[model samples]
Target: MNIPCPYCQHPITPGATTCPGCGTSLLREATPQSAEPTCGYHPRRLSLAICDRCGTFACAECLRLNSRQEVVCQRCHALEQDTPLPWDLREELGTFTAWWKTVVAVMFHPDTFPTFRPEGSAGESLLFAVLCAVPTSIVGGLSYMGFLSFVPYLLSSGNPSRDSVPSWLGPAMFVAIMILGPLLSAAYTVIQAGLDHLVLKMGGVTRGFQVTLRANAFSQAPWLLGAVPCIGPYVAPVWGLVARVFAYRGLHRTSWGVALAGCLVTPLLSCCLCGGIYLSLIRTLGGFN
Candidate 1:
């Protein structure tokens, strides 16, 4: 069994009084009791420690190290670790409400992200990404279809000679996109997560690809704001990138520099390469002229 040194989070050998890695003393005197009390969790065992927060009597088996490095009772530890986030309230609040609340929390209360238990698989993460992407993808697609279907007619309204796109084309395009767009977005999420995983690994994250994938998935929550008419296209991309940075920093338990480098480097490089290609194409076309 691997346990962490309370001071440095380095591995510690079991039953050791001092951390071999950090040389920090782990031995502590449990607050002495006048009379042996029954443990709160294990009634049969004599209490050896008292919870610093609640003053509950707990046996060795019922004691845990809390964030403050104080010995806490199992109940108190559970209270802190199991406080439900909005994401975990899906059944009670309904799917859309839960998702919206989660998005709001991620945007405004990012410190909560670190409290989120990272236990999901990559497929689960990608599915969440797909759901988040659907609203935006459909909204943007329909907006485009509307512009494509009606903008020409609006421009040519005064002229009777010009024709508008067939009425069937608009609904057809919208339907096709509503069906296919989410799938493509989910596929892209998988690819994007895999790419981000490489960068995160280089930055010293060892929690594996699923952690990165989940972070990437939750980051997509901001895109749901894209359903809010025209502003979404302009707003979601920038905010989503910011969210991803925080998500990585929290999920991987890494420094901000590592998180930012892992999250931004590949994307920035891709942008530079694409810009170069665009400039080269422009120069080639200019030469042809």
Candidate 2:
């Protein structure tokens, strides 16, 4: 007589104690039949081995039985337990837009933009922007007017002498530069600071207003190189490009769409504002005549 092996269903001699196909132990005596295997993922198989993480049962087909008897679903077991989800651009943009509104409001009133410190209010950032802009604009405007005077001196074919330049023109240019230049610089800086604040609030630590300002300052080095007459116009774009780079970096931390828009529009806006001022002054001086 012969019997079927319990492990591999192979036929064996009646006295055989193990399955030849799988090396599994055979019944020593006739035993009762057992139930079918159950799926590991199903909840009804509570008595079966289950995955420790996702809580799925283990069976011959569903079981990921390992040497240690530790079993888990293939999908859940392979996932990285510590990895965080990627940031959502839309959500970041929304947060940036909200922070932008706050910045605008604070610009109108210095009391609004808060500071990170205990004594600092929301307006501390705005205050810093104003302080930096005032001095930088004053110095920058004076330097620009001084540089412009060189054009006339060069045209006059005279050794550049400050005394020869018209005194009234210098003071007039100074006043004009002081009045318009600081306001423009202040506004631009405020906008940048606001954008940086927004980026911080949006869970981005890669870029900040201080970093942007430092980068801009470094980029302006090329503009000084623009002092070479014919090269001035060509090199001037470097300053504008630097500004756009800062803007794009800030936007990149927030949203790619916003960065794209900023890269296209910021230079144009700066040109319009600064150029309009320059052209207006020229017209007032009868340069159009």
Candidate 3:
């Protein structure tokens, strides 16, 4: 979260007091007669940026980046100091270890989300989502490949070549599923997260999209259930929705109703549409028969 220099509109690093672009001091004093906006706390100092939390003008000396990477006034910053999630401490915890801790925490201890930092970079959130998605995709693909591998045995009934699935078909299907499963999962995660963010916005959430994205991604912790053989994929979707609702409520500081609606509405609509299409196709095929 880089701040733009008030003097030159050049991007400055967060917490930087001086602009490297123009070598200008961020804490310039306001002139007595000039008609420039002054800091809410110090009338003699020029305002550098408006506080994201309080919406008050603040001077460089009064402004600081909060735990969420938002530029806020000193008073607002002092009001909240959140602890970072394990995912945010990847360098210290090691990437895989941090991700595993975050998954467990999100899946079992979601109540702590309100106390953890709400903001993570968009890339970080997406990476978490992809990580969650990959395992489920791979497991589901493996299950399908296993079924395909057994198809010849079942269809052939002791005959190798007659009434059996093509020898190459199983491997072909395996290759296709292995390649497409993770890609589709990643796409679904992005699209569904975007839809959830829109619903959260409609529910009057003032937080940025990255916050919603982070919540949505972390909510997928339950997807780890895919490791369980037969029932994992079936159970993961319902559990994921439950986790999503909690994530939305805790991270966005919104009501349970808003969070539930945000997490459930898109999925429900999709189910209805698919169900309708399936019924129509069945009816058409029956008429042909």
Candidate 4:
């Protein structure tokens, strides 16, 4: 009689103990020769295997694969999919730490992309990018404020009156930076993500715009690196670019080549276009002079 191994679902001879396919200990006892059990869902059909989750008899039609690759009923499968990823636990874990772990995981483990559903609002994604920009902006702003406050003192030649900066200017700059930094960052993030989505469409990405936004948002997690004094500004952009490539590939379910083209082409084109405009403007002004 044909018997399937519980571990790997490989067909094996009846009365076998250890599964040759997966080497898992088949602690399963043989089914008794008594009356055949009916499926929990369809009473007319005979049960082939028991649902590992609910302990109910399941026919082949009712069998579904769980996260552990074990056989489960359709209800269990639906429930499992309905459960949230760690990234969605901001309410329980606090906003910064939750997104932080998600970012770290995405940067380190691109293969786990399948576990994330890439389902969130573009507005939500923009807000996330804005929040991620906060620490970086604060660090940079504080540095700028420090320079403004101290430059006059250091350059005074022991006289504070010469080239003195207004006391209110330093605090004013800090307040302005704190207020406008996140707003500007969020605006730029949204615009750039929209542009990236257009490029992604050109690359045959079929996922909706929301998914694209999510990928873009999560990829900007490296922006947190800008909190560092010297290298933060330099490293964050490069790190973000690399992360975006993987994020696009995973979220769009597209090839690496497509993801690369989508993520890089729009930004490169925009840079070239802006550079050309700047050069043209410079030449025009030089001619006028």
Candidate 5:
């Protein structure tokens, strides 16, 4: 009579306590006799053993065992060996794209926004970068334009000099710009690196965000070319192009023609916004005058 061990689904002799092949305990009671072949591993007189991997049913004699001693049919074992692991490119892209969106959201609205540490320790770095960049950018720009110097000038005992621009204002603004400009740049670079890391993580890429951020930072070292005097204007466009390229690569996990479109559009949009603000401020000042 055919019998099968219940544990490992391997075949065993009738009335056996354990399976010789898989060490699974056999049924204590003997199964009813039948003309049809019963599973050698199951004493319940079942027709087949189910393959653990692919769920194929096979008689005890048909079962092929593996190193794990789990019963698997021949076809399943062969397919298991041949099949490759699953990869989801779209899931990867979603993850990175989500991360950058998070960074932008936090940057523009930190007071109301909350930080999420989906990529573990990276959340802290991202938060630090944002905290530094926003304030630095605003304050640094104002200082570069000499707005803050008016405070000390107003407090001075003597009346203002005849110079078109105030003497103290130029020196104060220069000091603020010199001190704050590089600091703002550094903060922006750091924030950008964090955002890049978040992008890589979102793309379902298992690589650490810190590693990706470091690599991107190194690749973008050319952004420092903005430090040059006559050459600085040209450097901004190049840096913008590089930023768009990196954004595309990190967000989509693949190259596409739209990346060039982003390069062209982003700078133009920023300029328009800045021009609008400048015009509004000029009108307000003129109304007061």
Candidate 6:
């Protein structure tokens, strides 16, 4: 994003201290021994604003609006851009709306991720993953519950052993599916993201694990489709994987190849391992026969 130079109205690039068109100095010198506060970094310069992150006096040259649109000192801004995700502004946007907007952005406007700060807490990302898991988990649980209820009717028509299905089983399954499923999905999201981060590290990512975790969580935006009954569950994972590639690349400011490796390597390896194990099991069983 560009900001206008107050003097010439020239659009200045982000983090620039000098105006190109006007050749004007953005920083102003504080009068000697004046009551006005001087910049923290430059004692001779007057403060234009206080840094939001460090709460220190900052001159125009030392201040920049971060991705969150908060004015912070260049030093603090460099450390935490706090790229504004709608989900992070839940207090203002409200929870569900923030989540929906973030999902839409992740699914449709993935290019926007480059503007997002790669810094976020694991707790925040996990909460997002859990929210993304909710619709599918609830739908799956309800579907299972319905199937369980239907099973008794189907078995009763031709069998006398139908009473073998316990009465408490349906409710227990419902609780487990509805309550535990989303939580498990969130846990899996964290684990999968951690594995992806390891791949990113191999590919030369310098950012912390939280960056990968947040990317993974945001990529789960496609999982909202899991509310659509049977096909939703199948579609979500595939769509999410595609989104994950974009998320990793955009957030990490990495090459597309590195992003793809980070998102795909672990999953591909898992699939290959599982396939090999299955083939081995089948061969062993055939030999026994």
Rank order by lDDT, top first? 6, 3, 4, 1, 5, 2
Give the alpha carbon lDDT tens digit for every residue of 1-289 in model 5.
Answer: 2345666656564334458978754423335765544544554545455676567545544566653456676665554342110111225546445445433433333222111111223333333333323333444555555654555465553765545456567566766665665566556555655555454444454545554443333233343344445675486447545554554444334343443443345456668999999999999999999
Error of 2 at 252 (Å): 5.3
Error in Å for residue 145 of model 1: 4.0
CA-lDDT, candidates in order:
0.76, 0.44, 0.83, 0.77, 0.47, 0.85
- Local distance difference test, candidate 4: 0.77
On lDDT, the leading prediction is: 6
| Residues forming the 10-long window of minimal summed lDDT in candidate 5 | 81-90
Question: What TM-score, computed on C-alpha atoms, does each candidate reach?
Answer: 0.66, 0.28, 0.73, 0.69, 0.31, 0.72
Q: Which is better, 4 or 5, measured by TM-score?
A: 4
Cα RMSD of all models vs. native, in order, equals: 10.5, 20.6, 5.0, 11.5, 15.5, 9.6
Q: Which stretches of model 5 miss by more than 4 angstroms? A: 1-182, 190-219, 243-247, 250-252, 261-266, 283-289
lDDT: the better of candidates 3 and 6:
6
Candidate 5, RMSD to the unseen true structure: 15.5
Model 6 agreement with the true structure over 232-286: per-residue lDDT tens digits: 8799888898899999998898999999999889999999999999999999999
lDDT of 4 at 193: 80
Tell me the tens digit of each residue's lDDT in model 3 across 1-289. 6678977999876456789899898888998999988999988888888898889998877888876678888888876777788999999999899999999999889888877777778888878877887676666667677787788788677676754566677667767876676667667777888898898899999888888889988998888897677898799888888888888998888999999999988988899999999999999999999
Tell me the tens digit of each residue's lDDT in model 4 across 1-289: 2458656888743334456789866543335564777678777666667777688886655667765556777776675573344567889988777777887886687666655766776776787788788898787678778888887788686885754677677778888898899999887877888898898898887778888888888888888888987898899899999889988887787899988987899889999999999999999999999
Q: Which stretches of candidate 4 lie over 4 Å from their true place?
A: 1-85, 155-164
| Deviation of model 3 at 165, angstroms | 3.9
Off by over 4 Å in 3: 1-50, 57-62, 67-70, 155-157, 162-172, 276-289
Evaluation by TM-score, superior candidate among 1 and 5: 1
Global local distance difference test of model 3: 0.83
Best by TM-score: 3
**Clash pairs of candidate 2?**
40-57, 113-122, 113-123, 114-121, 114-122, 114-123, 115-121
lDDT of 6: 0.85
